[model samples]
Target: MFNDMMHILTTQSGDILTALREHILLSLMAIVIATVIALPLAIALMNHRRAGEWVLQVAGVIQTIPSLAILGALIPLVGIGTVPAVIALVLYAIMPIFQNAYAGLTGIDPILLEAADAFGLSKRFKLFRVQLPLALPMIMSGLRIAMVMIIGTATLAALIGGGGLGTFIMLGIQTNNNAELLIGAILSAALALAFSWGIRLLSKLSVRRIGVLLVSAVVIIGGFAGYRAINQPAGTITIAGKLGGEPEILINMYKDLIQADNPKMDVQLKPNFGGTTFIFKALQGGQVDVYPEFTGTVLQSLVKVKGSISHDKQTAYKQAKTLIKQQHNLDLLEPMKYENTYGLAVRQADAKRYHLQTTSDLLRQSAQMTAGFDPDFYKLSDGYPGLKKAYGLNFKNIVQMESSLRYEALANKQIDVTDAYTTDPQLKQDHLVTLADDKHFFPPYQGAPLVNDKTLQKYPGIAKSLNKLSGKITNQDMIEMNYQVTVQHKKAAQVARTYLVKRGLIQ
Candidate 1:
């Protein structure tokens, strides 16, 4: 596990750094913008006295909108990426800063203001000398709280292609990989803690020398902006895709390959890992260039085909190619050997007790069993809802869970059965029994790269290199690679390189 952590740290160090930096910048920008707007509004509201309750109520209403929902709503008007994420976070951080600033300014003794007025001090002079100076500590406290909240909320930015620590967690959940999830969670928490401590220290120092501290803050903020401008490259490439499973892994694999081949390319991989429908819309709207997709997913989810096609690999590939080209103006590249098919996984002991050797056997006893599935299954047409109808198997209960939690759920006897991918290494490692699908309702899930037609025309080499990787990686290979990251603790890039060398794709 230590080795795996180190591997991930080394390989994804760039992405981790980028995520942390972007998150910090976004949070700080939000708080700063909120402060600029809120402080004056707060002062005005407090002075009017009659408007105090209304202002507080208005700020309270803004706070009530859920962060994720606000971000999602902003995507359409502002579109996906960093801008919307920043705007959403700024709006979310406003109330805390506004409320505290208002209370701090109002709570001051009226005698101080009267003295300033008696001394013939202008309104601006009184605000700068008396109101702001006295309220600095309380305002700083609010800023601190707002900063912390923004840091935590920034993790969700990955959903809209903002690219942060949330990508790892989302991918981990999709592929039922725990190591990535833990790493993502830990790194985010550590970053937040570090920022919190730094802010607290600043708050303390501010009390002693306010002038110096304010100048230092401005310099620090300016320094960060300069660093980002220097680091940011000229060109950009946006990659988008649906949430869950092996798709993200494949995208990262391709990204590494591209960068290794041509280091000068400023390839920015933007992951739009959300619901399948969400990603599909992004692709159609030209929000992304390439994403890993399965033939079966396109057939069942996109095309909305009811029944199944032949398991013949060539047949499936041809159908997928035709469908993508005709319907979406997209290209389905060479298919990989790995097939992430849905299957019923049961604990070894349970399977043995029930003599469940196949789906038919499991179906016979389905009424007495309970099952767990990834949350998406509840929504997808070809998911559990469709599977039950097609097979006529009814479980005693159905539990919606994150994919990573499904194995534990089954082992702990929380559920008797689980919907799992055929290539999951845990099925072999944990000695879980997988029942064969005899009904053939599930289509061929051969992995392939889907690209916008324009990208293929522009980067012809990309297609060539990716095709070279096709059929080279099998189901066993995928399981082992996934295990390396999730169980054995190896970095995804290292595993990919090792596999490529072993397969003679790269030297």
Candidate 2:
């Protein structure tokens, strides 16, 4: 693990530093924006107690929505990237700052104000010279809270391509690289602490102190803008992928193929895009040009196809392609040979002991056992609910968790049954057996490239470049490549390069 950390630091030092700077800029901007709005609003509402309470209540309600949900919701209105991410952070930061500012101003002793008035001070003079100084500590406390919240929440900006430490964390989860995850998490906590400490230093504010802070903020903003202006690159094609080794490898494969054939085309990969839905959203929103997707996912989730299994596999794939093109203006390229559908898995011991060979067999024992599934499975039509109704399955307990953690949870015997991808490498390593879907509950999930029509029109060679791998990868081939990463701890790029070279797809 130590060696892994060193390797990452050495190879990705520039990326790490860039992400840290972006994180700081994003969080600080949100807190500063929120403070600017909240401080003035709090001051105006100081005498209007009833109105203050109402405003705070409304801000509180906005804060109740999950941060990711708020960010996702803002995509359509403001579009993706830093603007929406900063907006979400600012919304979350408002409540704490506003509430604290109101409390501090209202709680000030009336005698102090009376004394200021007796001294023949103007209203502005009293606010700046007397009231604000006394309320400085409480206002700073609010600022501290807002700053800390912004720093933590800003990590999610990477999901919308805002770019931050969260990029490393998401990629780490997708690739199962502990060093990357730890680096992102540790840096985020450190940033929060540093920001909190900086805010704490302003417990007693003076005119000069405020002036110095304002100047510093201006300098930082100017520097950030200059950096952004100088860093813009051209001819970049953005590629995104869902969470998992397969997607990671596929995205890397696309990058290599595109650049190898068309040297002028530069590929920028955005892997571990949280989920299939988010990836699709990014493509449709023009945040990403292309990504790997499963035909079954497009048909079932996006097209909302019912009774998908009734149609032949080719028919389902063709219908999905046509509908996606007509509705979303997205094209589904020729699919690979492999089909990675969901499967119910159990430990080899449990399978042998219960003589479970099919979904029906597993159902017979489900009443006495617990099952764990990925969160997406809960929403799928042919997933848990459909299976339960089909076979009358009622597990003793049902746990919904991340797909990556399911295999480990099953191995530890924490769950008697869990959802597994047909091509998951851990299945072979842990000697887990997949129950046959005798009832044919799932649709075919052949792998393919889902590209935006605009991207194809802009770069006509993209489709031709991507279709080289069509019908190339078989089920066993995908399983072996996944094993090379998850079990052997090989890098996804290395695995992808080796396969493409061996198959003579790339030089």
The sequence of per-residue lDDT tens digits that candidate 2 reaches over residues 1-507 is 889888788866887998999898898888877877898899999999999999999999999899878877777677667788889999999999999989988999999899989999998888888877877788888988888888888888888778889888886776557898899999999998998888777665584578478668857865876787588576578988776678878999998888888987778887656666666777888778999988888886787554533435687789889889988889999888888988899999999999999989976788899898988787676788887787788899999988778888899999989988888887887889988778777778999999989999999898887899988988779988988765565778889999999999999
Candidate 1, residues 112-154: lDDT per residue as tens digits? 9899999999998888788877887888788878888888788
**Candidate 1 similarity to native, TM-score:** 0.78
List of clashing residue pairs for candidate 2: none
Candidate 2 — which residues are off by over 4 angstroms?
Answer: 1-21, 44-51, 122-124, 165-187, 226-231, 306-311, 346-381, 384-406, 409-418, 433-440, 484-490
Error of 2 at 406 (Å): 4.4
**What's the C-alpha lDDT at position 118 in model 1?**
100
Question: Model 2, residue 171: displacement in angstroms?
Answer: 6.5
Residue 356 in model 1: shift from native, Å? 5.9
Clashing pairs in model 1?
Answer: 4-489
